[model samples]
Target: MTTAPGSTRNETAAIGDGLRGNAEELLRELAGPAARLRDDQWVAIEALVVDKRRALVVQRTGWGKSAVYFIAAKLLRARGRGPTVIVSPLLALMRNQVAAARRAGVVAATINSGNVTEWDEIHRQVASGAVDVLLVSPERLNNPDFRDQVLPRLAADAGLVVIDEAHCVSDWGHDFRPDYRRIRTLIADLGTDVPVLATTATANDRVVTDVAGQIGTDTLVLRGSLDRESLHLSVVRFDDAVERTTWLSGHLDELPGSGIVYTLTVAGAHDLADVLTSHGHRVAAYTGQTDPAEREMLETALLDNEVKALIATSALGMGFDKPDLGFVVHVGAPSSPISYYQQVGRAGRATERAEVVLLPGPEDTRIWSYFASVAFPREHVVRSVLEALDYERPQSTAALEPLVELNRSRLDMVLKVLDVDGAVRRVRGGWLATGQPWTYDADRYERLDAARTAEQQAMLDYQQTTGCRMEFLRRQLDDPALIGAAPGSGACGRCDSCTGIHRDTTVDTEAVAATRARLDRPGFDLAARKQWPTGMAKLGISLSGKITEGAETGRVLGRLNSLGWGRRLRPVLDGPDAPVPDEVVQACIPVLREWDWTVRPTAVLALESPDHPVLTTSLAERLADIGRLRNLGTLYLRPDHPPVSAVNSAHRVAALYDSWEVPDLSRTDGPILLVDTLTDSGWTFTVAAWTLRRAGAPAVLPFALATPT
Candidate 1:
């Protein structure tokens, strides 16, 4: 046996003997008395406890990966080691783990964004040796104060380091997160005697190799079959949104028990939740936009069967432990088979049978392309960000937005990447350049993009595959059990393809009509931007603070990504300039009529669209004629100043600062209706309204054919 550094062979053997003797009893304590460790589980526990080496376990979701870690942690603590530090990925996962630890008679505490007020106390408990396991989100690993002060102490004394959902540590994984890269530093800081465990259920061969290498060269890997016997997988295709909704509305209750209905976009979740509720199904929309507290409540609600399902996006994917979850329905397929496997794995973890259905939409590819656009920025963009940062003084994200072309979310992602690369450091106020020379890995990014495209193709293949659905997924994940299986012998005997038990695609005609009517109904409120983005003056604009005279709450016919009116308006907004469509005109009339405006507009004004001039002008004229309002001249784009192409808010506002030449509106009596083809960022309307209000118009009411959600 190999002895740990600075330990004699006698000591190592003594520790190994103690671990071997006590492991099963600890497992019984953690799991129920009747529950016993599987041979692989014991192998993993012995590796961490006796061998004192890093191990990577790639098993199915409900395969008692948590039991192995919790039992190992209890044994390690009993053997005079410090507490275990688990770098968990999600708040939901952390909550579940903490509860599981408590049930095992192990004391556990979590430090996350949702529990800021408890952090100091938790830190105190850890320092006082009162906490056995500390669960922290990967993002917390890079917090400046925690990194400089708390992490070093924890790393120095931690007995076992666990990375839950460890696939996230690999860029090749479906959900790659830059924050997870910080785990490399944490692992480096620990003593060689301290053991490490990285657990994930959805890693392919490439991801497993990548993550194993990152953990250590001597890491042990325990991989098993990726199939879930309880899952009965199938795909249901629909030609249009109305047909999909009709089928879902008619058949949602027939699916086993309360479960999740996944959507590709946030707007789709909200829209589908509304549709489901209207059909008398108890449901709520949960997305990245959901508040943390509300998310906790909704999770509990789902656990208690308070609602039929939480119409959710990928936000609710990992580490949610509802063992009895009966079904998982995807309204649109994710971009990769690995992602699909992870999502559908949430069902049937502790149940006998669960239904997994994918209602693949034609719009799924378009949504995937939209998400793919936010991949790593070009080399010049990274260089621009680095050059804009001050080496001594920190610059907040808002302060840098004016100097860079990336939006808030993309900018944050870039900054985090740079921070991980040691090119920048996030301090108390914001980010500071570390004077570290950094090379933009163009080849690496290109390779990643290529891999993503391949994964997308694999997802498409999964939807169309005729062979065993479970076997196809297992092969996609490079499951070892399928290596030598006879041809056509790996079928699960459960999926629709295997059993010839496809769901009836027939949706009721009346349900279809009602869904179509609901989808066609237009209009959503466009809340005005009340505060100007900071750092505007640095971009040569003097604006800051509240915009008292900005446009009032506006009306949108539909969102471009919305289920309703989005399909109809995309052509008008994205296609070449032409006469406005009559159906679009009819849609606008109802929006205007339903709008509970304090005072109706007496004049119509159109914002000049260089790309869609004919469409904008025709719509303005038609509305003016119909409303019997004066036709105010258009707000023309100033000469030599083309429309703003900047993506971030501050630069967008700066480009629009003096770009518009508003016609005289001093003679306009009532509120003047402002027209635009689409609204993104809401900056155009705010700036134009400021110009018009300064030019003596009464109140400005912004209207648009569509806006992005």
Candidate 2:
């Protein structure tokens, strides 16, 4: 739970030609920021400057997460601190750090995106000790060309390396970058003595340990509560977007800080920004397609409070900070709950009360469908890409695309698909492919597929839940419990989930009339679940034993089979022929029926699906009832974040779990409680459950704790 703040993790330096003898004093004299270091910062500051070994300090955002880099640079500039290089996943973040360092009167420059003449000058300054930190994106450092151009030419192999957004290194991280995996080799190429400092805000234990391994550095993961207590989490569910937008406009006037309106698509972001602007809200529109300067200007305006709100896509946040942000409202469901958590986290950075809101629409399905279509590669395409690689040195997604006669967009989709499937990984963009991509075992794929399915179920649950959306998310993450419930609020309030906002079950009688009006969808607006205003109930079971939780694969085939009910299980197995055994099903049938009533139909339907291979004995073994809770990052390859697994486990163990909660867990009262437990494998899932408890709900909470490693 404790890790060194991003600071000194290395201790070797060769002074600028003539200054070796007095480097320490000279470096200290040059480093001066006497006022900002309050008593609170002293602990982190001293921990970093006092030694050149490992240490971790978790301070809130705006408290100077960047200052740690400056201090480290000063130490490195001193005789003993280490020659340094910082690899960040976010270019903006790196720029911010470099800017901060230079502002502190410390010389700093970057070797990314732009040309070499500048890099060479910066390199000279670094070697001469005029510049203390050389900031680069993993793209530049991992580039064989970039490395060849710079590494040997530097003063010495950088003795200190800091990876900002360290979570990217973990395959399980929310923001996984293939290039990050190659960092281990870069570190190896740098020599073993170099101590690496890794920093990130969203990582859990799994991410923390994975990062340590990836960087080959003793980890310093400084963790705090996943819950941003100052932030009040809420969601708005509406019959349609018209209702959503109109309601949002009204809420915007009441919220103190300017709000962030998140849309699922770039076009949606543009339209919403325009609409809000027309309504007299000086709104800034942001998305990936935006020009850098424009994005900068708009973001600056928003941060400066010059505007009342900003309407953008999810691309607006990550690796950037806006502490004054008061609220974030999603217009629709994101592809995954993890995406939701990140967007919501952007708000409430200020010390005052903040709110996170969600407004889901039926069109969310279209959004998800689009994401799935583009984000993941088709199976045949994957086969083809791997086949194409059979002869060539691994190529870029573009090169492989034409050979397979696919378009760039299609090719990119396939690549992303394979990445999540872990079937093929372009770890260093183009340089690092899984050495044996074809060797990916069927069992592993099935296991991962099952994990994804469970995650999807959790998302659906949050979308459809009728209670507090925030609380539902937390409970699924298995946070400790909040108990002692009081009574429920009777008013519908402004949220979409209130029964007042929607109609009860309908008959087919209105189909013709609804069709005449070109009404949204013919069937139930399943996504309507996000509107429930009150909190949630908590209950889920975690399967134990037969698998080492913290290991590379935390699967329990035996239990999975037992639950499948005496039938052939087609788990996404690794290797050529890891099919489900017949004998395993016989043992599972009796257990399946006795397990939970809702479990049978879903399990059967899942078995009939094309992706049934994901259902192994332990794959869907965990099951729990939907408690007032929320969850995410549960199914990733991260072992540090346990709440995600419990949700997945709950899906496997639950009597019934559905995507039907509305205004999930906003009200209802009880002592906040979360279920903290682990799988037989020693990986932990924490946080989300507790966040759910805080939102509201009174029910049994459970998490399958990992056995101690």
Candidate 3:
């Protein structure tokens, strides 16, 4: 057999023989001396260090994927090869990798969004060969400075390239990040002799194939059994949010040890965390909105077992490593079984008999639909974006928002995808069109959407399946070991279905009442939009700078996605137009009474809600009567102009620029209460309030039945 391109027969033999001993020593340093490298781990390391070939390792979460790379880095570095470059997905993962590298006597430094100040020093260390491993987020790959100035040298010099959570590289992956596509370009720039490795615990057959094809057709695939004996899986159905929270509050302490409680929404996390805290459990909320410093502190707290669990969103899913984590309870099921498997895999990694429970809610599909809406835009939207961009000039996202129908986050996602596809370039100022011909790839996107839908159905099936939970997940992932198992021997005999044992589904009456009361307590501040979105002038709107006359801080009865009022409000908002429900009207009374406004409103006004005219009108009239305030007539929209669509702020404001015909409020005194059925984007309230204030109202106090979360 011929040796790899960069190695002679003698060198290959030395790598095979002497390298194993060194790798074992490094593993002992990384893990304790009692630890040993599994055969598959050593196989991957040999493929990388000995054969200098690309490899993809699909192992379970606790299988020490990190060890294979760290030991390989050390072995390669010992041979005077350059430092390894790791494309990590999260800051939490980077921190763990860096600390683990130190245990192995490898110098590892990370440069990510959280450490902008340390980047220069880290770069200097990498350049001086003082760092054995450098971890960077996938987003850093496309950073203009990094892509233009730093990546070429790093790619040329990297001894080994590792993509952790490599399933994300594929659109077929549940968490398909566009930035991971940039890795293909980086790999293309690498020398033929440089070895590459990609690893993930959650890839299905499609995702694995897609990632392997992207990495290289000749890549070595080391796939192991996707089974964890320590996890006992179960699904508990809940009648409502109150029951779910009550059950958690009643049963949290009974869990094996500190672990995670996941919610689908940030608001839900905070809400559940609050409920659990009130029940005398120590918990903290973690989400994308969590500050980096606070996130680090919370992560440390969890690792130290100071907190019972972290109530979190998907932001906590990918890289959090807690070896003895006792449980993972999902308040709502994720959109797919692949995502569910990855999340539940977090528990029982190092401990025996960890609980993995799913409390499926009726509202889960609604939340899933909301997330699905943010996917790749329609072909028309993409073409519109391309047409609006300038070929030579860089335009910020803010500048382009008014010209497009997409929201900031969705537009940013589109731009990133476009940049990765060579249709646009993200430069110093912002984005520049490359004038490159680009196709919409409708077939690929349709397939992805279909796969997502199928996965969602599979998740629902998993929840309702009577067979072994682990076996079902394995089948979904197409685990290779299933083929070798004896017929009728696939069951682990640990899951609720297999063992015929399930957690208690009953919630105490008092606990349920308390949870209901807590959730029913409504009112979240609807912060006023203070600054005008940039580029309004381009839309023929003269608005700019601070809004001298705008709505004061507003009050929302509750979010449309809130645990308690959400259940009441979703139907009212989503259904056909009708008078405001008595329940919602009653809910608003407490909100107004509890609002800490500086001055009481003397008059009430309603914005024209074409979809819910009766509801908005009835709400305004009822509030005026209840509060004993003047009933200012409705603000009618121009006949030709429709209600502003829920696009970005700039477009919304422009649509509402001259659309509302404010009623005469010159005779009104104190604050004018502006009532609308729903508040999304908050531009309607701002523009309407600005119109009211300009029309001689002293102040505008915006109140809404609900706001979309």
Candidate closest to the true structure, highest TM-score: 3
Best by the lDDT measure:
1
Better of 2 and 3 by lDDT: 3
Model 3 pairs whose backbones collide:
none
Model 3 lDDT tens row, 1-709: 2386788898877758787888899999988989988999988999898778899999989999999999999999988899999999999999988999999999999999999999998888888999999998999998889889889989989999999999999989989899999999999999988999999999988888999988887989999999899999999999788898899889899999999999999889988998899889999999999999999999999999999999999999887888999999999999999889999889988887899989989989989999998899999999889989998889999999989998899999999899889999988899999999999999999998999899899999999998899999998898999976663377889999998998888878988998999999988788999999999889899999999999999999987777888888888888999888888888889899988899999999888887889999999999999999999879899888865665888888988888877777668878989999888889889998888777788999999988787
Candidate 1 C-alpha error for residue 246, in Å: 0.8
Note the clash tally of each candidate: 0, 129, 0
After superposition, candidate 1 runs with Cα above 4 Å error: 1-21
lDDT of 2 by residue, 225-323 (tens): 344556665555666454456566556777777878888777567556655655566777788788766777877787789888878877676656676
Which whole-number lDDT from 0 to 100 does residue 502 have in model 3? 82
Give the Cα-based TM-score of candidate 1 against the true structure: 0.97
Alpha-carbon shift of residue 256 in model 3 (angstroms): 0.7
| Backbone clashes in model 1, listed as residue pairs | none
What residue runs in model 2 are displaced by over 4 Å at the alpha carbon?
Answer: 1-64, 80-83, 114-124, 151-156, 375-380, 386-400, 409-438, 441-445, 460-709
Taking all chains together, each candidate's TM-score versus the true structure is: 0.97, 0.57, 0.98
Clashes of 3: 0
